[model samples]
Target chain A: MVKLINADEAVSLFKSGQSLMIGGFLSCGTPDMVIDRLVQTALKDFTLIANDTTTPDCNRGKLISAHKIKKAIVTHIGTNPETIAQMNNGEIEVDLVPQGTLAERIRAGGAGLGGILTPVGVGTDAAQNKEIIRIDDRDYLLEKPLKADIALIYATYGDAYGNLAYDGTTRNFNVLMPLAADTTIVEVENFSDTPLDPNQVIVPGIFVDYMIVRNKHG
Target chain B: MDKDKIQEIIARRVAREFHDRDVITLGIGLPTKSIQYIPHDIQVNILSENGIFGVGSYQTEENYDPHIINAGGVGVTIKAGGCFIDSFMSFSMIRGGHIDVTVLGALQVDQEGNLANWCIPGKFTPGMGGAMDLVVGTKKLIIAMEHTAKGAPKILKKCTLPLTVAQKVNMIVTEKGVFEVTPQGLCLREISPYSSLEDIKQTTEADFITDLK
Candidate 1:
């Protein structure tokens, strides 16, 4: 059973130097309230896993701007000047993974797979130091799975049991992170006692450990 | 050729390559513009790497939802029966080779059909997004760009900048002409009506087989 908790309690799980997988594309589909709470905390040295660190004022970018994130595994960071500045100055470590491979690695983590074989970064700098395996005479890079201490996700609807339903592009990374983390927390805009339609539910309640209702007035 | 006209011609030519029911991914910049020129008769599902499948063209500002956007962060509508997935599933369609064609913008395409478009050295680059995956996973890859950058030939003997993916381009569509990548080298397939073979020779630095059929 997924327990409903307030934002502060949800973010309290975060600690210094813990790896976190946050769900968002830019700012959309992000657990902003949780992020705001995380910002309020003095926690630092976070290793962030996300699609992109958005603009300075945006969700994940706020963390980057605050210098809370020590390392980031992301696909893109061009939109945020702060992240670029930090990366260039050696203030933060940014490992820019190919977007597809990043997704598959997360998926592998969630699915309990050891790793995936992909040809995406072959012959490129992105494949540096990675093992390449040949199956049937074709080379594929072995990308290890990615997991985290906690995963933060956003949803349009969540039931008392934490069955989650996402809306639009907001569903991007939100749906995958929950499966790959030790503790999965979802921030939902709407919550109901009744379960979401089985077909409508993107992430089942079994994967979710905690649910936070998004602050309505904020 | 007029600049806009050249873009239109190149877009229209690329649009012709799209067939009905093809799962296609369009890169940012000029490739995204190609959607407007896509023929009305053929309905291709435009996949956005940001987790959108069967994406439609730009939506009116009045009806736009800020959250509903394409891979480029522009508001867009979805085609009938189209659905949304996460970036993981979106790239699964890409890396799993479920996509048919990917039209990308290129900075330089070498004689061996290699592409270099993501960045220019000494300039801050955002890093590669889904370009590397698309180049390898899609069945066909097309490079859509202007023939020259500030009058410097982009079709080169070898890419001076970093390579996005090696020897993966199947076709190159430029304002001046259309080229097909082959084992021998780039083959000139179609010359733009506005430009001539001499114009191509004057601007193109790479050796291309003049096999105009």
Candidate 2:
């Protein structure tokens, strides 16, 4: 069973300089209430692994604007001007990975695989500092698995057991982040009184550690 | 030509590349505009890297769902029978060579079919989103863009910017002309009605083999 907590208690689980995998594609599936609460906290210097930092006034970008993120491992940052500015000013370090490669690396981490071999970045700058292996005369860059101390995800519906169901494209990184982290906290919009049907559950209860039932106004 | 007309020319030309039931992925910006030009009779499955497999047209204000968005973060409608996927599954379909064609706007394309569109070093360093994966995995890679940038040729002998992928581009549809990238080099296939052979020759820095009518 997963314990249901408030947003304030969720904020207390973090420490400085921790690596967090945030689930979202430019704020669509982001844990808004948790992120909002985290922004008010004194925590800083977090390493964020997400698809994008989003915009300045939105979700993960708020963490960047608050100067809480020391480094970001993401696929895109063009939508967030603050992240670009921070990267340029040396305030935050950004490692730009290909979106597909980023997803596969997280999957590899959760699945306990060594790493992934991909031909996507073979001839590009993304291959820099990475090991290359050749098979059948084709070169592939070896991207290592990425694990995080915590994962912050969002779900449209969650049961007491923490079985979650995401809506639409909001399931982007949310499905993968929970598996790649030691502690997975989901900010749920609607809580069901009964256990959710197994057919409807996108994320099983075993992967979820905690749940934050959002306030009515939040 | 006017900016709208230039975009129309490129979009219309790129739209002709699609066939019925072809699974295509369109990059953000001008490539997305090509959706409007796709033939009505031909139904294609649009892939959005954000996790939807059968992406439909853009949504209006009334039908806008914040959760239903394309890779560019714009609200969009999903086609009938479209299914939602996770990031891992979405990329698996992309990197696994299931996508038939991918149309992307480019900053530079060299004669040797090298594509440079992701970064400009210090000026523009937006990360390579899924372009590197799409270009290598798609069955056909098409580049849709203007012929020049502020009168400067984007088609060059060598790409000054970093490459998204090397020697992967199959076709290029520009406002001025259509080009096929071959092992021998760039071959000009069709010239746009608004532009002449001399105009293309003058605006392009890369040498191309063409017998345009």
Candidate 3:
């Protein structure tokens, strides 16, 4: 059974050298509290699957600027100049997936689907010796699904049963990230005691393993 | 016009569209330039997909943190009382409708207002980035683009390519004019004196008409 905890206790679950599927494309839809909690832990050498690493003072970006992460699978590194600096300096390993491909790969990971083929990143430096699958006699690049040891997710609202409701704009990565990891942690605002309406539940309760109620500290 | 000149035309259009106190997200190219020209007193809070909301082009050198980026993933700085967040948290803000307006770049805008930002035929394509989500999720969408690309009118009667977001554009600002998509078709609200409806039609693929006075 999943345990219910506050932001601090829930985030403590992360450890050094863990593969983390942190949800969000760019900066939207991150589990802020869990990220905040990770800060307190000083966990290092973590592998992150996300869209961007961000800058030092960027709310969630500090993790990268502070050197808390080891590797990342992402689309672009435009915002985190330091991250780019690290990459250019060969201090960081970056696997730049096309944005849509990255999201589809995450979804495939969660759905337990094998890698799919896409035209994204094709004919570019990004398309290295990855498998090229042929569909309808046309060549498409094979992209692999990405799985992680842990998943950190954010939501606008949640019920005690772990149903999630994400607000717009921030809904980028939350929908698929929960299932790609062994353990899924949700940080949410306004936890409700009543069961969430089935019609509105974006992330089902079954995929969630832990719930962290967002508080003032978050 | 050259790319820079075209962008300037788009810049002025976007700067004029700023709503006071609005929380805004600007996409790549001209959409991002709105920040550089806005009146300083507008008090619009800016959000970037890469994760900074309180920012602009004129950030101090000391404040050049790389993680702080705008919707285009370009590095930026934050204003006072601003907080840096994980990219995931930033997406949550967008998914949750926390942003009031989003300015997207358009490769092709169909008559029904669907957008195609990725995969241009015979031309190179870029990542869809966050456009698919922004078009579907943001409360309002404003597209900024050249009136045509390589002399081909991208304002289409219907999307001929894969769609990034379905029927989400509310307003469009191009080098040639400003248009609002309505039930009838593209409504030309503002047109450059040098251009006309027929001129737009020569390049536009959609059925468009001058708005009723």
Candidate 4:
């Protein structure tokens, strides 16, 4: 069952040095209310797993610019100059993963697979020192699965039971993060008493643990 | 030629390489501009790493949907029969060798078809997005870039910077010419109307086999 909670209460669940998977791409699907609440917390040394830090004044980038993030595993951070500055200055440890590989690793974690065999980084520096397995004379890099303590996702519509519906591209990572986290919290634009349409529900409430209602789009 | 004309020349030339039913992906820089130059008769599907397939032309401001942008974060329309998916499925199409071709921008392309595009040592790069994946996964890899940057030849004998992938590129298209990466070596295929064989030799640092047949 999913419990409906406020943003402040959701923020209370987080602690320092924890790992989090935040669902967003350039602020489209980010949990703004939860991010706003998390910014007020004194938590530091948190490991963030996301697409990008977004912008310096937006979403996960706010935590990054505030120096709350100790480490970030992301695809790009060009828009967030603060992240680049911090990375260059060694204030934040950045692990840049290919966007596809990052998505598959999270998918693998949720699916309980050992790891995925990919040829994406074969001849690049990304392949250096990584395990290579050959099948039928072709080589692949063994990318490991990834999971986190918590996953913060945004939903356009969610029920009390936590069934989630997303609008347009906002469904980017929100559908997958829940499957890859120990606890999944959603920030939603609409809170409903009745269930969402079965065909419309992209994420089943079973994977979701908590919901924060915004009733407004970010 | 002026820089914009150079880019236009490169874009127009690169657009000729596509076949009618090719499932192609284009990178953000010069390759993205190639779409406008593609022949109107050819029917090809354009895939975006940001979960869009069959990406169409730009949207008007009134029709713009923020949640419906391409990998480059530009608002685009979806072609008929185009479907939306998450990143996981999109990459599956890439890494599973389902994409027919991928066109990308390169910083440097060596004689052996090695690409060094993601970074320049001691400089800040946003990091490799889907360049590595597309190069490794696509059946054909086409590199579209300027002939030179700041008076330095981008086509080189050997890339001085870190490589994105080694010996993966199949074709190279520049403002001045087109080169094919054959098993023997880089072969000069076509020269632009603006340049001759002597001019190409003078500009490019890489040793290419001139098989202009």
Candidate 5:
């Protein structure tokens, strides 16, 4: 069953320098409250796996603004001006991944797959001799998977059963990441007592460890 | 050289053949023009990965509001009965291959259906953003670009540069022609009357064969 907790307690699970996977694409599906709690925590030396930190004050971007992230293995960071500033100033290290490959790596991490094959950035720096595999005498790139100690995700709603439903874009990372992390926490708009319909839960209860409640529509 | 020509090309390509009720994703930059081309009566769902589905008209600037944004990180308009959700899940839709047709712009297209729209001459273009995910995950993909930039061909025999995605370019629509890449080779379907085979070949040193359709 899921339990509700305050933002501070939820964010406390994350410590500085820890390898974390923060789920959300941009603003949608972001664990804003958890990220907000981290703003004042003054943590650093963290390795982050994300698509992009949410917009300032919206999602995990608050963490970036607070200088909490030391490095990011992500697809894009253009929206987070602070992230850009930190990277340009050498305060943070950014490993840009192909969007699909990054998602696959996360999925692989969850599924116990060590690596995957792809055709993104084969001749570019994105493939700096990581590994080259050939099929039909044509080249494809081998990409390694990534995992996290903790994964924080957002969903539209959940039940006491810990089933997850993403409202919109918020489902981006929430769908596949819970299984990829050692611990996955959910922040849902509505937390109810009724068990969700089996088909309605974007994420099943088995992968979730905790749930936080919020009112998104109200 | 003419605004009318650019608009015509942009319009025709955006409304390409596809399932009538599939979900569509549009990339940023020139590909943005595609929004203007979609027919109003079409029932297809136009989604902005930022967070909005059932996105509305792009022509009326008044229709755009700050709260409605697409995955490209730009403001957009939402249609009636639209619901705003979170963007994190929007990306989940992409990662899970829920997208139907994803149209994007390219910098270079090589003989083997590869694309290099993110960088050139060692200078970075806006990195891969959501493109790799959209291309690999979308059911089908298309690339649109100017035939050449600065009089040099953007299409080449081999992308002698960094690429955003490889072998993901299923079709190429330049101002000059519409070409479909297949197991056979670069097969041409249309060419602007103003340009010739020599004109395209002269733009880049890529090998070419004519399959005029």
Candidate 6:
């Protein structure tokens, strides 16, 4: 069984200067209630790993706007002007990885792999300071896996066993994030008393540490 | 020319490049506009790196669903055969050479076929979303942009900005003309009726071989 907590308790698990893997692609599958609670906290200097920082007033962008993130390892920050401003001002460190590389790195981290060699970033600035390995006369950049202290994810439905099911494009990063963190916490929009259908279970119960049900007041 | 006219010309020209059954991905901004100009009879499957395949037209307020969005974060609808995918599978399709063609907007393209669109160092450092992966893996890579930037040539002998992918651009479509990137050099394949060869030469910084009369 998975431990069910409130939004406050969920945010309480976060610490200042810890790394977080947020599941979302521009706020589509993001944990809104948990992020809302996190925004009200005094936690600062967090390292955020996600796809993008959404818009200025949305999802992870709220953290960027609130000056909570010290470093952001993301694929794109073009949608969030606050992130861009912070990066330009040197207020925060931004490590921009290619989207595919970012996904593969997270997948590698989750799968217990040391790293992946990809041809995506080869011969570009992304290959800078990275090891170039050659096989079959083709060069590939050795990209290291990326793991986080905690994973904050959202799902359309979850059961007492923590089996998660996502909807539509919202499943983008949510499916890969749960296995890539030390503690995986999910904010479920709907809770099922019984176990979810085995076929519909995207992330199994073993990977989830806790879950918070979305309430009307939350 | 005005912005709308430039977009129309480039978009219309780029739409002609597509064939039926082509699985294509369009980058944000002007490249997305090409969908409106695709031939009515041709059927192309669209892919969005946000984990959607067979993407269709954008959704209106009445049909808007927050759960469905394109790579640009705009609400969109899916085609009949469309299906959703996870991020890992989406990138797998992109990096594993399944996509047919990719149309992208660029800040700069050069005679050497190097593309620079993702960053500008201290100025515009919006990360390379999936461009690096798309350019390297796609069967065809087409860059669609204006002929010049504020009266300065965007097509150059060599890209001054950081490259998105080195020597990977296959074709370039501009309001002025269409140029194909070959091992020999940039070749002016076709010139728009509105622009003269001299006009192209005056606005372009890169040397090109053209048979336009």
Question: DockQ for each candidate?
Answer: 0.74, 0.88, 0.08, 0.66, 0.33, 0.84
Candidate ranking under DockQ, highest first, comes to 2, 6, 1, 4, 5, 3
Output the lDDT of residue B149, model 5: 76
Model 6 lDDT tens row, B121-149: 88888899988988888999999999999
B1-213: candidate 5 lDDT, tens digit per residue: 685676468547756644577788877766667666666666677767656767765525755443345676555566787665443455567656788888888778887888776655333433576676677667777787777777787778888777766777777777777777778777776677767776666774566567887
TM-score of chain A of each: 0.97, 0.97, 0.92, 0.97, 0.93, 0.98
Which regions in candidate 1 have their CA more than 4 angstroms from the true location? B1-3
Question: TM-score of chain B, candidate 4?
Answer: 0.97
Model 6 stretches astray by more than 4 angstroms: none
- lDDT tens digits, residues B1-213, model 1? 578887887888888889989999998878877888778888889899887898976889687786688877778888898998888788888988899999999889899988887667657668787888888899999999999989999999999887889888999998888999898878999998878999999999999998997
> What residue runs in model 5 are displaced by over 4 Å at the alpha carbon?
A54-58, A119-124, A132-141, A215-218, B1-8, B17-25, B35-70, B73-102, B120-125, B133-141, B150-152, B167-170, B179-189, B193-211
Error of 2 at B183 (Å): 1.9
- Candidate 4 root-mean-square deviation in Å: 1.7
lDDT of 4 by residue, B50-81 (tens): 77889988889878876677887778888998
Residue-level lDDT of model 5, residues A1-218, one tens digit each, is: 76667776687788788888888767745776777667777777788888876565667777777788888888877667777777778898888887667777888888999888776566567888689999888667888878898898877789888888765445666777888898887888778788888887778888988788865321
Q: What is the docking quality class of candidate 1?
A: medium
lDDT of 5 at A9: 69
Interface RMSD of 6: 0.8
Quote the chain B TM-score of every prediction: 0.96, 0.97, 0.89, 0.97, 0.84, 0.97
Per-residue error at B78 for model 5, in Å? 9.7
* Clash counts for all predictions: 0, 0, 44, 0, 25, 0
- Model 2 ranges off by over 4 Å: A216-218, B211-213
DockQ category of candidate 3: incorrect
* Candidate 4 docking quality: incorrect, acceptable, medium or high: medium
